[model samples]
Target chain A: MEMKFPMKKFIFYKRRTANFVMLSLSLLAALITIVPLVFIFYYTISKGISNLNIDFFTKLPTPVGETGGGMVNAIVGTIILIAIGGGIGIPVGIMSGTYLSEFGKNKFGILVRFFTDVLSGIPSIVVGVVAYTLVVIPMKHFSALAGGIALAILMIPTITRTTEEMIKLVPQSYREAGLALGIPKWKITVMIVLKTAWKGIATGILLGLSRAAGETAPLLFTSLGNRFWSTDIFQPIASLTVYIYQYSTAPFKDWNDQAWTAALALILLISVLSLVFRIITRSKYKA
Target chain B: MVVNEQVNITTEKTKSPHIAGSSLKISVKELSVFFGKTKVLSDININIFERKVLAIIGPSGCGKSTFLRSLNRMNEEVGGNFTGKIIFDDEDIMKLDPVYLRRRIGMVFQKPNPFPTMSIANNVVAGLRMNGFRDKKKLKEIVETSLRQAALWDEVKDILHESGANISGGQQQRLCIARTIAMQPEVILMDEPASALDPISTAKIEELIFELKKKYTIIIVTHNMQQASRVSDYTAFFYMGKLIEMDKTIKIFTDPELKQTEDYISGRFG
Candidate 1:
């Protein structure tokens, strides 16, 4: 009973060693994941930086094997496709997500969530085929509208699920505060619940958009690729992803170089989007 | 006004041992609450009087919050069902639309829950706008008055444009109070409003409660016996889903009728 234990010695050393090992392991894992990202930036930047210039952004693609060309039309088409896709997807996703979180708390909501998950898991190429049959066949041509539809379908579930999760993250107390003021349930959802989660919802939209921006398989059959500067959404349109796919696969050396530059442009667009959403999420608490 | 008519009608017929002939604002009759299957409050009856501070005091899990929330049907939000009759003023509140009824009997929760997405001015004016009051001059007057009444206007008058969350904990609670008062409810239900605050803030809230009693009948559920005694005119003690005793705050602390009340007031068991 009088024997004194080793004063904070035995457990302290053990805990310190264990903490060190775990910390090192975590650091290793982080580096391992970051290494691949660094490698991607390395290759894309090294290969693409030299090809980027004014003509690369402004001029139309020269015929097949030409030395100098740009994807100006493809860039414009991608922006239009994203606009149409996001316009169609974001509002519907937010509303459906609101219903799921706020009012649609029954068996039907569970089924809706399950179906949405399954839809997201479906292959993008398969979705492209489905769009080919649904829109391309009826219209008798592959148009930018069809491509936009395919991208919108991909975005809806991703946005919907994220919106629902973000809305759920809002404290129930906020809703109660709104209801205590005799605000209608729908009004409460829109004014209080949705406003509180708006940043998170916007992040979800950006993610969906970024995913849509990089997609190639879905647009291959839907938009079917274009070579000219076309403003008509009903007509076939070119996108950065489609141009990359076409040029990278072609035997022409110059076309492959243009494809690398197009890839860089897309990467920059997505990173900028990701950065904006990140800042929005960060500053939301300040608001 | 209907409460005045009821006071006249029941002035002679009622036989009450404590607080006799108090003009009743709300009458609870055969009230019982159940969360799905488990019963919480059982056949509780009390007369909440005109512009009075009624403190519902009990230990944790004693159905105190349940009983308080039941008054304004706020319990429904948490899936609590009650089988009873609560006559608010002269009307049975059970039949009234909950949204309309809540505007008349507003609630402040345990935590200070000001709308975080709004400015301080907007938070105070939220209920007024929800009720379709758009006159900016009148809205500004209500905002100033309510904040002043809650004792927060002096500190925050310059920063009305700031977000509700950009304030101290005590100030946030006061802002929530201002928000509720802007609604101009006849009855304000507070579930441990001062429980989350420090001593100084608690004292401030108690003083606000005393001042608020001039216009509103306040029902505050507090676990602190000292707080109950300090702020409330009438105190109702609850124990194990039953009304143990209810009397003037002085009598409840000094000499309660029930043994459990004495045990709790003496800090025997929470």
Candidate 2:
């Protein structure tokens, strides 16, 4: 095929067409990825916003067939479990991470790293089973402690890996400077390395907590879900995910509707937590 | 301790011509450094004088920084291991606690690395606090004195509470120097300390080095031959982990005995 126009103009037109086609394809890919996420938000808001009320935050659940039910206990219970999980997991994860990045040339560091990797790759439900065996069976009953432990186990691997990576981002010169000043190694690790990497570490902690908060299967095997309000941690407790799991599967129309609202509540809780972390990280004294 | 000092004085007077006039602060004996399995500095013997500026000039990768770091045992942090003895003012280097040794032989790195989380004032006195100096008045005094010594107090005194990273690169490097000096070290080692700065900052750092040598024994490593000639009383030329020539700075620049040293000085090749 011979072109009447100059070859330079023909090449330029072809190049422009190719650019347009590739750009459109990339935009279409982004659209396809975002559409599902948008649909999820739209579906949840449409189904659950009408069900949301002041009562939803304040009141306890009604019996299975009853109409006036709220997830106040489940919400409160979720907070307690997350608090417990984070309390145990954060310190362990951070210390292990410190070992990996700072003193990790040895065999023990490699062993710890391998175990953390394996733990993170393990299924969430398998962790639930381990928690069930270690805590639930030993106590002869399901308890909130067991549920908290399960979530903590799942959180450790993510927090450890992220902390290690974040600490690595701190320059090697900072450590050298501290050492040259005759500061103790432990003091340098805690004061210099940890402080410099704290913001990144906090992000890792938040991600781990958010991931644990939405987990259902881990809580299912350990806490075993309670319909009524319970305050004692030694006793079985209701959680948002467990409540949603149960309520969504129930035959009653009102119960299924409550699941939608419960999911929306969980999403809101994670979002608020993330927003709080973001603000704290971006504050004036960020260093 | 008194007898040991007398013996060091006699040995310093008789055996070493290069360090005859000035009293010795540190003596290196057959020191060799290795990073993992690879040797970086080998079979080195040198005498560093008290209250004098010594410069180590070499091309990149010649292990100048490694030799400087070994004086304070800072090389251990970077996977470099060494064999042999370093004597600091008559005490064997291996016997002295590393943490304590570093307090008396502080170091300044090539890059300006201030603790990001600390204020300028806090960065200066970090070492003092680590050694159990808790008096706020004393800490304030040390910060002022050290910052003045580094020629940074006038620029940073008003904003002592600001983050260390908030300062300019030159200021940050001076802040690192002030931080090291606040420890009250007897000797200061600088590893190409002005390599990352602009020419003006480099000049300022060189001036600071001249001022610093009156109170502290200083060992500096430099890539720029002019810098070595300007600020150093003694110059040691290293090539490929070996000290090729060691002499007075003027003699090394004007009348180096080795051909390699002459070539490097004349810009024939690195």
Candidate 3:
């Protein structure tokens, strides 16, 4: 006996319709996710572009009622603060990270890892208060050094965790190859394993630096903001984020406009940092 | 040399099962390996001849690789424990510093693992550079000679500074061989060196082995029976963590004393 069954036609048409509906939904969700970012960029550029000029970059702030001025000191101050922070943070972070990945298989290592995770979760304002008591109170004054210390503390946990994870991404076979060649364990970690993970480590550094650049609460109680030109580490320093905070709250319309321009400058600085790093660490093997 | 004295002493005590002109290079006695609670290789004894190829052939999970790694203490890297006396140049290798010992006896792994971060020329000289050999001219000479010996110089000379990984699989394996050769070790241990390569590449590696033994004592672990017979002067058969039989390659293939060896060679069972 022969058996017969019904075969549904246009089943492919149904699948195609379902696929189109799902694709459209995902595209809509992705566009919704970018709405806030697009709005921020739109407002920042439109309000800030009119106020941007040579004087906005080169000249010092004027007294009340006088409008034409720049944030040169603030720009230089941010650079110095970052340099100081990175000077303290990069080596400490990389070394500790190396220890965690290469030799941190014991209880002490687990404790250190836990503490770093907790440290990264601590509020930025809390770090500012800690720096206030540790550096500002002891020195009897707020200074650029205090701000730099706060930023360094914030940078360490991010850099350390990223470096450890990046180093772990290197294949175990590479370490074996180095050991089989009679190279010492330390040499292999530094020369081969660390070098192999360098691009990722650099990305971590950039992330930490970018976070430090945008921080205002940490700089509030530490550096305490400056109005005059100063390069001294022991003296108070100005930063763009601090200026944005102060000017945005001021009654004057010009200061409020300048705040938007300062935000634009901050964004540009971070962009330049990322571009420089991308060039420096670009792979030569890309075909 | 200390090696000459040890060879004379070993030849006097051991029966003459070696090739006519070859002398002992490495002698293993009471060797066993364990990983935690599991035993990998049982007590084994074998003699490796100077400048001669010895192939350790066995099926999967037969502890042939365990025996090869034990020669240079690379087993220690993976937390393997061993109980044995491996005499190299009259020195008990277990008592020697592993770093210094490994320099005298280098190894090539089953896969081609050139350092991806380094260029071809740099990969060839990584061991020397890391050991603080800074002579530029001599380093260049070693780069050329080592690549030539590994049969890769002609293929890669034009792109010496290219990344070590940006090459064909066979070229990369040959590059790893060149890297091991650059160290100028007295002995070379290969753990299934050509198993990861294509047929033509495997044949090229076999030819390189023939040329290499004249300058270094070679011990190779292989699963291919024909490869063992074609490239090795002597062969050792391993099964269930024990050495079942060992003899001249031709004799082992033609008329092995053990039935297991005959059974495996005839494709009866692994």
Output the number of the DockQ-best candidate.
2
Better model by lDDT: candidate 2 vs candidate 3: 3
Task: Note the DockQ of each predicted structure.
Answer: 0.57, 0.67, 0.59
The fnat scores of all predictions, in order, read: 0.59, 0.80, 0.64
Question: TM-scores for all candidates?
Answer: 0.93, 0.93, 0.94
- lDDT by residue for model 2 over B223-262, one digit each (tens)? 9899999999989888999878888899999998889999
Assess candidate 3 and give its lDDT. Answer: 0.90
Residue B33, candidate 2: C-alpha displacement in angstroms: 1.9
Candidate 2, position B165, lDDT: 90
Binned by DockQ into CAPRI classes (incorrect, acceptable, medium, high), candidate 2 is medium
The Cα RMSD in angstroms, rounded to one decimal, for candidate 1 relative to the true structure is 2.8
lDDT of 3 by residue, A40-146 (tens): 89999999988888998898888778988988889888888888888888898999999999999999999999999999999999999999999999999999999
The 10-residue segment of model 2 chain A with minimum total lDDT is A278-287
lDDT of 2 by residue, A1-287 (tens): 77776566688899999999999999999999999999989988888888899889888999867787688989989988898899889999999999899889799999999999999999999999999999999999998889999999999999999999999999888888888999999999998888889899999999999999999999997988777788778888889999889989989999889999998999998999899878877633446
Q: Write the per-residue lDDT of candidate 1 for residues A166-241, one digit (tens) a residue.
A: 9999998988888887777777888788889988898899989999999999999999889999979999999999
Clash pairs, model 2 backbone? none
DockQ ranking, best first: 2, 3, 1
Docking class of 1: medium
Model 1, runs deviating above 4 Å: A1-3, A7-25, A274-287, B1-22
